[model samples]
Target: AQTVTQSQPEMSVQEAETVTLSCTYDTSESDYYLFWYKQPPSRQMILVIRQEAYKQQNATENRFSVNFQKAAKSFSLKISDSQLGDAAMYFCAYRSAKTDKLIFGTGTRLQVFP
Candidate 1:
């Protein structure tokens, strides 16, 4: 059984600043993938970034990056130069290499203040 945990239920950041959302997971499987998905008011799940367990390097996309700690089973998302558009509910998800299912965390609602 794998589970994702986002201790912070909500977060806020000023525009143009940086914010880091924490995420941790418990899993016995060695092969898997971790993802950060952002859901805005539109209710669309957008893929922010992804990291494979076998990859030693963290994944990054533009202002979005991940701190992937495979040994500690921790994956955190960092959003830099935050903008109002970045305000959304971010979910940490896990997908087994053998399965198509994605197990998501409770999600952290990020609010960007002007």
Candidate 2:
């Protein structure tokens, strides 16, 4: 069984500031994929970034980046240059390559204020 955990239920950040969201996952599989998705009021799940378990380098996209520690089974997201548009619900997801089954965490609500 695989499960994802988002320790932070809610996070607030001021515009232009940076914030990091903590996420940890438990899985026995060695080959898998980790992802961070953001859903705003529009209710659409947008892919923020992704990482492969075998990859040593962390994944990054624009202002979003991930700190992936395969040994600790931890994957946290860092959002730089926070903006009001960044305010939304962020979800940590995991997918096993063998089963292709995706599991998601409860999510962390991020509030961006000016």
Candidate 3:
């Protein structure tokens, strides 16, 4: 069984600052996918970023980037120049290319102080 771990249950950052949320997973499969999803208080799950196991390069989306260490099974999200809009519950998720259901970590609550 695979499981995702998020050490930080809560985090805070000032507006325009950066924050790094840590995540790790236990999985035996080599070809799997990892994702970061954001849910504002509304509770809608939105895909933030994704990384494929075979890719050596990290994934970047505008102000968001991922530090993917495949060997360590660690995937962390870095929010650069954060904003108030970035304040939300960030969830680290994993999905096997061979499976459909998404396995999510507990969650990290991000608070952006303006």
Candidate 4:
């Protein structure tokens, strides 16, 4: 079984500021993919970044990055230089390589302040 948890229910960040959202997961399987997804008010699920369990390096995309700790089962997302457009519901996800099943967290609502 694979499960993802976003401990923070809501987060606020000022424009041009940086914010980190915490996430953790539990899985008995070894091969899997961890992901961060953002969904704005318009209702679109966008992939922020992804990290493979086997990869030692963390995943990064533009201002979005992840701190993936395999041993601790922690995968947190960091947003640098946040903008008003970045305000959205962020979800942490896990997908198994064998089952190809994707599981999502409850989500954290990010509020961008001026």
- Best candidate, TM-score: 2
- Candidate 1: Cα lDDT at 75: 100
Regions more than 4 Å wrong, model 2 = none
Candidate 3 residue-wise lDDT, 1-114, digit = tens: 889999999999999999999999998888899999999999999999999999999999999999999999999999999999999999999998777658999999999999
Worst 10 residues of 2 by lDDT: 20-29
Mark the 10 consecutive residues where model 4 has the least summed lDDT: 1-10
TM-score of each: 0.98, 0.99, 0.98, 0.98
Residue-level lDDT of model 1, residues 4-107, one tens digit each, is: 99999999999999999999999999999999999999999999999999999999999999999998999999999999999999999999988767999999
lDDT values, one for every candidate: 0.96, 0.97, 0.96, 0.96
Give the winner by lDDT: 2
Give the per-residue lDDT digits (tens) of candidate 2, residues 75-104: 999999999999999999999999999999
True-vs-predicted CA distance for residue 19, candidate 2, Å: 0.1
Q: Least lDDT summed over 10 consecutive residues: which range in candidate 3?
A: 93-102
lDDT tens readout by residue for model 4, 1-114: 788999999999999999999999999999999999999989989989999999999989999999999999999999999999999999999999999999999999999999
Error of 3 at 110 (Å): 0.3
